[model samples]
Structure formats: structure tokens, C-alpha cells
Target: MKKPKILVVIEYIGENGNSTAYYWSQIIKKLNINYHVVLISPENKESLKFSKLYNVDSRLVKVGEHNKNSLISRLLGQIKQTKAFIYEIKKEVNNCQLVFTGTNPIVTMVFLSFFKKIKKFKWLVLVHDIFPNNLVPAGFIKKGSLLYKILNYFSFLLYSSPDRLISIGRDMTLLLEEKIKKGNVVFIPNWASTDKNKPENKNKNEIILNLGWEDYIVFQFFGNMGRLQGLPNLMKAIKSVNNEKARFLFIGSGSEASYIKTIIKEINIECNYEKAFFYGYLDLNKNNMGLNACDVSFVSLAEKMYGLGVPSKAYFSMAVGKPLLYIGDENSELDILLSEYDIGWKCKPGYSDKLALLIDNITDEYICSSMNKNPRKLLIDNFSEDIILGRIEDVVISTI
Candidate 1:
């Protein structure tokens, strides 16, 4: 008997600093019980997800690397990529009944979506972030502009390409249901197994002891510090704390790092400001060491991101069972979660005093107790890798 075959399609084959690629890779590996994997991408770029299955592939195809300039240039690349993708995966396309595309980059998903239609294969689209919707008008897409109209219209239609949409959060699912086939939508939360993190009730490791015993608190910020994430206020709030001992640690970067640097300079404070420190962007996947270093994990979304995009970090933090100091605008998902769950506290976005006070108040015991609650039980029940991967398998098996 032949093993089931599945094609995992992503926008590219690159190892982005982002965690989605890693998650994509892991899901496919876990699905091996039902499918023999065939990985496809537009770029020859590195993806740890693709790397592991390279030898196991029924087929591994790189349709194109993409040229990032000019519409015509990019579209031309897409067309060429589409053609090569079809040409190279001709066998796997037929052998596999299901195709799944994207944790991000709708363009890549679009190509795979189009391919499934031609091959008459069933495909599912992973809704990672609600694009164009998440794009702020002033910074990303200006208001009353043709590009704005195009983005809004395009993103709406893009939601339709998937025969089914697999979503990572409620906010994203709600967005898809409004625009696409509601029957095709499913709430699939991003999840990490509990085995990945060691619970730290009274973590008195040598490392913790060597690094600790400080008068001030450490406000930790990890992941991409971008405009969409609203990190300026994070740093600003830290500055406002006005405590010689309280410090801020920012890890990771994006297009907005320069602006944050400017804020730090304008404030004329030295790096690490007494207790302020940055372990810098940890190659998080390299080892689990870095993520284990903290008592509390920070959750943030740009002031405007509320209701539009669910922070991916939310589920991950819960998985680790960390006390979250979720900072965002009023009525936001994080705000509601922290409030109702009692797993953590909330800080009003852009309000330094409130954030400062919250950090000052957190106790090690509080963080430990919250982690013990398994607040993500609802999230895990639906979105664990097992459930989501199984759903993808079913989509493929049904098409076949």
C-alpha cells in the first residue's frame, strides 16, 4: 500500500527570523503518520521546516526566488514561479490529494491555490495575519489612495482562494468568515506542546541565581520590534518608569528598529540603563535556552492591531504558562484575555505609568501560579498541532 502524500507549500524556502516558518516545518513532520511529505516553495531559501524533510520528499520544488522590486517584475516572477511549480511537482500534485499553503505571504498561497484549482486538488490556506486589514493606512497603506483600495480589495478576494481557511486565532477566523466561505473556516490556534517548556515555579537554577538578586525589575520584550508591534511606547514606558533599577530588555528587530533607537538616544540613556539589558535576538530555534530565561513574557500589538490581528505570541506564552503583562489598547484580545483569565495582568497601550506600575507589582509567585492554570486549554483543545495537522490531512484525503 502506498503511503498518503501531502504537499506543504510556503511563500518561500527561506529561514526568516519569524517563527511561523519553524511552526510550518514542525506540523508537516508531525503529520507523517498520514502523509509522505512533498515540500514546495518559490524560493531556494532556507526553511528549517523544509530542511528536515529534504531527504523524505516525494518531491521538493523551488519554482522561483522572486524579485522584490516593481509590480511587473514581481508578477512576472509569480507567473514564472507558477509555471515551474506546476512543472516540477507534476507527480506530487497528482499523488497528493491535499495541498496546504502559507502561514503568511498570500502571494505564495495564491500560486498554490491556483495550482490546486488546475490540478483539481483540494487545498487549505493557513490564515496567519489578516493582511491589508492589519495594514495601518498612514504607515503601510495611505488612506483614499488607489493602492489602499487595491490592497483592501485584493486581501478580501485573497481570503476566497482557499477551499478552506485554517486560522490561528479567533480574530483572524472572524475576519475570514465575513469575507470567505464560512463553511470553509476553522479555528486552529497556534500551539506548542507542554513538553517544550519546563515549568518554573521556583526556578533556582544556577543560571538564574548567577544573573539575579537585583533591586529593580526587568521588563522583557522579544520578537520583531516593528511599527505594527508598537515598541516605541514599550521603550517609552520603560523610560517613564523612572526607577534606577528597573530595566528593559528588547530582543529582535524589523524595519522600525531605527526609530526606536532614536527614542533611546533622545532620552539620552545608556544601553542597559543600570538594569536594562538585551540578550539581543536569540536564535530561538537553536536551542530552548533563551526563551527559558525569563519569569514573565511580554505580549503586545500595535495600538491599532486590536480586533484586526491576534498576537501569535499569545498562545506561545500560554503554552509556556508564563504570566503575561499584555499591553494593548482597550477592548483588545489581550486585554480581554488577561482580564477574564486571571493568567496575567494588562497595561493600557501607550500609557507608561500604567505599564510601569504593572511591572513593579508582579511577583515571582504570581507568575508561577498563573502558568499552572493552563489558561490555553480552550486554545489547545482546538488549535494544537495535532488537531490542525489532522484537519489538513482530512482535506487532502477528501480531495483524493
Candidate 2:
């Protein structure tokens, strides 16, 4: 029997590396199904490599050039991209059995939700981030602004129309339940590929030896350095610690990279110990080596960001068997995992003093060693690639 084909639309696959690409690759490889990817133009080499590796067909839509400096240019680019995406999807979707997507390219979700052609197929929306709601708290727009009101209404309409909505956390599902039918949503947390293990001997790792991190308890914050990460508060917490034993590392870049750099510079001027380091971004292959170099992982979210999106890096930290030190909403999904699994610690957002205290408390060698074992076990039990994707397969089979 022939396998069913599903059309998956995401904004961009691979200039650098993305969790979305990693995610779909696993599903395509393991599931007995075919996938067609619709992406925006200026496709990168990494995306091509990913397509070849996964045996999935990719179709690119030419949305004009993106100009980051100009708001008008950005709006025009999205307009073109949305139109192209809608046209291409309309042409190809009729042959597919289901349509699967997320809310990344907000324009695509806005147009695709209402497109008549899509209503014929089973539609599944993976809610990675809740918009307008997130934007308002982030200060991107006023809560009562016309743009906010318009997008909020569209979000309600779009979310309500989907046959199945897959949310990344329990809080997100609860938030959606207010706007969407309870039965239409399913909670499937984001997962990481568990192909790598924690290094047996950190002393033998070349990267750690080169960085001279072997002597310190490395606390790494990897992935995007965006505003929602609450990184400024983390830097403040690190400065207040006055500890020689802990070294904080920031990886990756985004809107807040420059601000993080500025804070680091300010802290260095006033302090004798080089308490923090910024290494920018690493390639996909080096991710394991980087994670292994650290003793513990740091994850943060602004208090307002709760229920808007889950910081996916926490899953990667667990996959690599490193305990996480999370700074965000207490009793959140991450907080619950840390508490129940005995794997890590959590503090309220912006509480650098409390964060420092937590770090100090975990410095005992026995405590660290004991905590390390639980992360990978947690991954195997709940967040492993096989387990999560298997759930996705069940959903697909049932939907079809």
C-alpha cells in the first residue's frame, strides 16, 4: 500500500540550523509517510542538505528580499511571501491527505486558515508560539492598538478553525481552550533528538580543554539570545554572585545580542573575575560538544512570556544529560519537570540573587553528579524523539 503524503509549511528551514528542521527530519525518517515542505525563498545550503538527508521534497516560494532596516520593506516582503505561499499551497495541497503547520510565519497562518482549498484536507496546527498575545506583553504593540485587536481576532478565528491543534505545553493548551474547543487541542511538548550522550570524561573533551572551562562549573545558555529569554536579568544575577567557581556562557545571537554584550562589558569593567563569556553561535554538528563542555544548562524566560511559548532549549539540555537552571515562571512545565525529576533548579524571573543562591547550593560534587543522571532518564521516559513522534504518528493515523 502507498503511504499518505502530508504537506508541511514552515517559514524557513535552514540558513543556520533550526529545531523545526531537526524535528521534521526525525518524523520523516521514522514514520511510514511522505512529506512535502513549503518554504520561503533564498533557500540556504543547509536546507538543501537537510532535504537530501531526509528524502523529503521541498518547494520554495519566492517572497522578495527581506530588508531588516525598513519596516515598510519588511511588510512588503511578508505580503509577497504570503501570496506566494498561498498560491503554491493551493496548487499542491489537493494531492496531499493532510496539511500540517505552525504559527511561525504569521502571514501564512493568517491566509492559509481561511483558504477554501485547505478546508478539504485534515489540518493540524502545531502551536509553537502564541502571537498578538505574546507581542503585547513584549511591548511590540499596545494591547488595545488596532493592529493588536485585528491580529487577536484573526488568531481566534484561525485557532478555532483547525481540526487538531498541537500545543507545546499545558499552559498553552489552557490558553487556547478559551478561544478554541477543548477537544480540538492536544498537548505535545517539543522534543530533542537524543542521538548523543553526556561525555563520560569531560577532561578528555577538546573544546572544554581549549576553553579552560575544566576548572569551573560551566553554566551555559545556548540557543537564541532574544529579549524573551530574560538574559539581562541572568547577567545581573551572575555579577551579584562574586564566585570564582562558576562561569556563565552565552551562545547564539538575536535582537538582544548587542545588549548582552554591552552588559558583559559593563560588568567586566567593574569586576576582577571574568564571570561571563559570549561565544556567539555554533554549527549543528558542534552542538553536542558545546553542551558536553558545560556542567549545567541555563534557561530563562521573561515572566510575561509564560504560556506564550516554551523555551525548547530545556529539552536539549535534558537530552544531553545536563541539569537545567531555569529562570522563569514558577510551577511552569519546566519547573514541574525540574522539581519532579530532581534534575535542576528554578527561580522567579529577574531574581538574580535567588538565582545566585541556587547556583551556590548546587555546587556540591555529590549533588551535581546525582542530578546529572536524571536528565537523560527524563528524556528517555518523556521527551525522547521516538516517544513524542510516536504520539504524533498516532494522531496522524487517527486523523486520516
Candidate 3:
């Protein structure tokens, strides 16, 4: 039987600390079993390795370097990247029976709006992050401004063009359903890599022992420190609570990393093991180790960020059996997960006093010894790699 050709267009396929790349690589490998899969992504060592490993056709593009001095520069860089991606997709559009992609370079979706009509191929889009809606929460644009209205309308057009829309979170699915008012949204939750992440002994783990955090209950933040994370609010809470019994660890770098460091210095947290430690960024192995060492993992979202995006790192933390201390809307996906499973605590973003109170009240005995093992068990049952990949394959099959 001749298999239908499907083109996978994703911006990042590198496996170095990129969860999207790793998962999509798994998706490509799975889809290759049933479909003639072709991939278009920026050229990288991991992407090349994946293409050879899976024996799938690949069209690799050279991504340009971007200036990071200011937001405007970054926006310009993103625009350039989107144009390149669109050009590559245009080259391969007519050759494939279906096009599968995620909203990485979001502007590419606008071009897909045109391509789908021109080529008349079934387009399946996974919404990793909503664009103009998320931008408002990131403080990049106003909610009701003229520019926002224009972008939102274009976003609606882009979304309406897709044959099926895949949402990673329940909140996101609801938002999309309301926006396009269509029955095409599919809820496919993200999964964690069980092969790479497993629960380790907090007491004997090298990351914990070497950092001298054995005496304190560690609350760790192990992902991007960006605007949407509400990191400043968490920092404020940490500053207000100044408890010697709890240790704070930040394990990734982003735009707010410098600002977090400045706040840490202002709080005069000792460099020793008493207060807080900031490690800029670590590789996958080290990050997994850090996840294993923490008692509670922090997953936060800014105000009005309920359906914008869900942090994928939270799944890795859960895979290692760490409870979440989520700071965001009570209606967020994390909040619903925590509330349903009794796996963690929640707080609103911007409520520094309440967050500080909650931090002070969480005892070492409760968090360390009494917390349940549902985190890892939940993944084994629901969010495992095989399970998510199966769901994704089903969506692709239905689309085709």
C-alpha cells in the first residue's frame, strides 16, 4: 500500500535541553512507521542525527543569528526566522499530502493560512502558545489596542485555516474552542521522557549533597525565568519569607535571570547554603538531577496567563516525583491537575504576601516525608511517552 506523505514543519529539533525537539523527534519516528514522513527544520546536529536514524527525508534550513539587546531587536529576529520558515514550507507544500506543525515561530501560521488554501493540503496545527493573547500577558502589547486587534484577527484567520487544532492543555482547548467556535480542537497533553528522568534519592543525590541543601527543604524553579513565569512575584515572596528552613534554587536562565540575581543580592541571601542559589543553566542530565533533588518544583504563570502556555518542565519535575508549588490562576492546567490529584499547592501570581505566608507555613515534615508518590505514578499512567505519541499519531491519522 502506498503511504500518504506528511510534512513536519517545526523550528527547533535540537535535543539539548529542548523538550519540544525531543518529543517531536519521537513523534516523527512514530509517524514514520505508518506514513511517509518529511521534516523541515533548522539544521542542527540533533536534527541531522534524527533524520539519519529514522531514514526520513529532511530539508534543513540555516537559521540566522539574532540580536538580543532589546525587545525590538528580538521581534525583528523572530520576523526574519518566520520568513525563512515560510519560504522552506512553500518549497515543500505541494509535495506533501498533509502539513503538521506547532506554533513555535507563530507568524508562520499566518503564512500557513495562505498555503493551505493555495495547496489545498490538510493542515494540522498544535498550539503550544497562543500569540497575541500571550503577548498581552508578556507586556509586549495592550489587550484592546489597534495593533492587538489586527494581530488577533490574523491569529483567528490562521487558526481557522487549520484542519485540526491540537491544544496541550485543557484551558487552552477551551480558549481555542471559544475563539474559532469550531469543533476541531483536540486536547493532547504533553509528556515527559521516562528514559531520561526518574526519581532519585534526595538525600544521596549529587546535586543536593554537593550544594549542601540536605538540611533545608528545597523549592526549586527548573525552567525558563521569563516574563510569563511571574518570576518576579515568586522572588518577592522568597524575599518576604526569608526562612532559614527553606532553600530556593533556580536552575535555568532567561530574560529575567539578571533581574532575579539583582533581587537576590538586595535580599542579602548568603552565598553559602542558607538562603538561595542560582545556577544559570544546566544540561539535560544535570537538570534531571536537580529535579530529583527538589522537594517541590515551582511552576508559575503571570496574571491573565491561564491559557497562554503551559510550562513543559513541570512534567519533567513530576516524572521525578516532585510536587509542584504552582503560582498562577486557580483555573490553570497546573492548578486543575494539582487539585484533582492532590499533588501540590497553588497560589495566585502577584500575591506576594499570601505566597510568603504559604511558604512559611509549609513544614519540612509535610513536604518531605508526607508528600505522596502520585507525581511519577501519574506519568506512568497518563503522560508517558508511548501514551502521548499514540494520541498524537491518532490525531495525525484522523487529519489525513
- Model number with the top TM-score: 3
Better of 1 and 3 by lDDT: 3
Give the per-residue lDDT of model 1 (tens digit) for 32-82. Answer: 656677776544436544565445363445555555434457667767765
Q: Look at candidate 3 and tell me the lDDT of residue 187.
A: 92
TM-score of 1: 0.78
Report lDDT per candidate: 0.60, 0.74, 0.82
Across 119-153, the per-residue lDDT of candidate 2 in tens digits comes to 56788888888877888656678878899889888
Write the residue-wise lDDT of candidate 3 on 1-400 in tens digits.
Answer: 9888999988777556377887788888888998898888877788888788778789887777776546677677667777777777778778788899988666566777886777898999888888778888878899999999998887787788999999998999998987788899999988887788888889898878888888678888887888788988898898877566888888888889999888777665443434777877887657678787778888888899978788898899889888888898867788788888867788988999999888877744555566654788898889999999999989988998
Which candidate leads the pack in lDDT?
3
Worst 10 residues of 3 by lDDT: 265-274
lDDT of 2 at 256: 86
Better of 1 and 2 by lDDT: 2
- Per-candidate TM equals 0.78, 0.90, 0.94
